[model samples]
Target: MADDTGHTTPTRRELTGRIGVGLVMGLCGVLFVSTARISGGESIRDESGSVAEVLRERGRTISDLTDAAASKRTRIEELTQGTSSSEDRSQLVADAVGLSAVSGPGVRITLSDAPTSALGSIPGVTPDDLVVHQQDMEAFINALWAGGAEAMMLQDQRVINGSAFRCAGNTLLLEGRVYSPPFVITAIGDPDAMIASLDSAPSVKVYREWVEYVGLGERSEPLDEVTLPAFEGSLTVDVARTG
Candidate 1:
């Protein structure tokens, strides 16, 4: 080593001593850094914990968290499936019970009372024979149902499982509402099938006979699309029998 002014130089022993001190200081620094890194919290070990013990604790915590996350994910999936299934079932039930509107290819039937002028046109004919009756509507309803009708409507209301038709004079009484002829019955299904059922039903045949004999007004037409409203009346069916 030379002095700052280049006027003095270090002896060989002095140079050797300086080199040893530098080596010792470098070793000490290296040792200090290594010890601090081994005990650092981010390196999986603190001052009080060994390397193996720290690694084991961290592995267990990671496994537990992973298991907990997997369990919650499974429960969430189950809940999602259950909710969708319930909604699908509810929709099916509503459609089956006529509590939901339906639209599709169908048939429409109109039944009206005969004109007053036709009252005496047929022999042995009475006033009842000139007008549509509850039985007439019931027969048609039954025929439509037998024809695989998905939904049916009478007048402006939907026909459900417990639909009851009653007549007052020449007007139709249904579900606490009054309707005058011509009464309309609409069914949503295969038009060809429903028409076949209407043609084969005995009761419908009887009504057709009346149509031919007394001019009782009856007309059937196929519709490209027919819509039926949901039933909005009471769902009760009161029955009485002999005790």
Candidate 2:
């Protein structure tokens, strides 16, 4: 046997150690893969939740805007329906106009005068002093609403909820139409009440003075059968896109 010079192979203890190391390495690899998967899944979930929340908020906002628009449309419809009788229509018109007049049971105020003062001592009125400015017109319209006018029309243009009264230079721009001096603003309301409300407004008083002194275009004409036009404009809300 000695002559065979047999050499012992690796012991069982040594073999066990090699096997253990391999097992530990395998476990570590599995743990790393599991962690990575969990992290990635969580990121995806967060992104999805964020997108859903944003969509919900947008839906809510759109719904609110739609409701408001619908309400306004309904109000307009109620106001525009024709009255049963001409007398009723007249009364309705009277009530509305009452809330919008600048003076008495509805007064027609006219402003006209000589351009220049005569010899003793005076100067000619400038163009600015003669015409009503945008602000003046706006003030008058706003006062009408405060007074109780159900509806209003400037010249032939019907003033609606979305109506914008604007002035460019000395000319008035309303609902895309332009009018020169002596602009007519007609409203349907109580004649006396409308005039009272108008007189109550400080701005109207100031304008009245201007009409008397410098001859700015004056307020006038409380016609019993004055009719205003229906509002003509788009009523849609524009939404912005999200990237």
Listing every candidate in turn, what is its Cα RMSD in Å to the true structure after a full C-alpha superposition?
Answer: 30.7, 18.9
Candidate 1 residue-wise lDDT, 9-112, digit = tens: 97999899999999999999998888777767255333467644555565466557655755775576477575777868866887889867888999999999
The prediction achieving the highest TM-score against the true structure is 1
TM per candidate: 0.61, 0.48
Best by lDDT: 1
207, model 2: CA deviation in Å?
Answer: 1.0
Clashing pairs in 1: none
Worst-scoring 10-residue span by lDDT in model 1: 39-48
Residue 212 displacement in candidate 2 (angstroms):
1.9
Give one digit per residue, the lDDT tens place, for model 2 in 63-99: 5765576578668658866756864775565454331
lDDT of 1: 0.82
- Per-candidate Cα lDDT values, in order, are 0.82, 0.61
Alpha-carbon deviation at 221 in model 1, angstroms: 0.6
Model 2 Cα shift for residue 210 (angstroms): 1.2
Compared to the true structure, candidate 2 yields what TM-score?
0.48
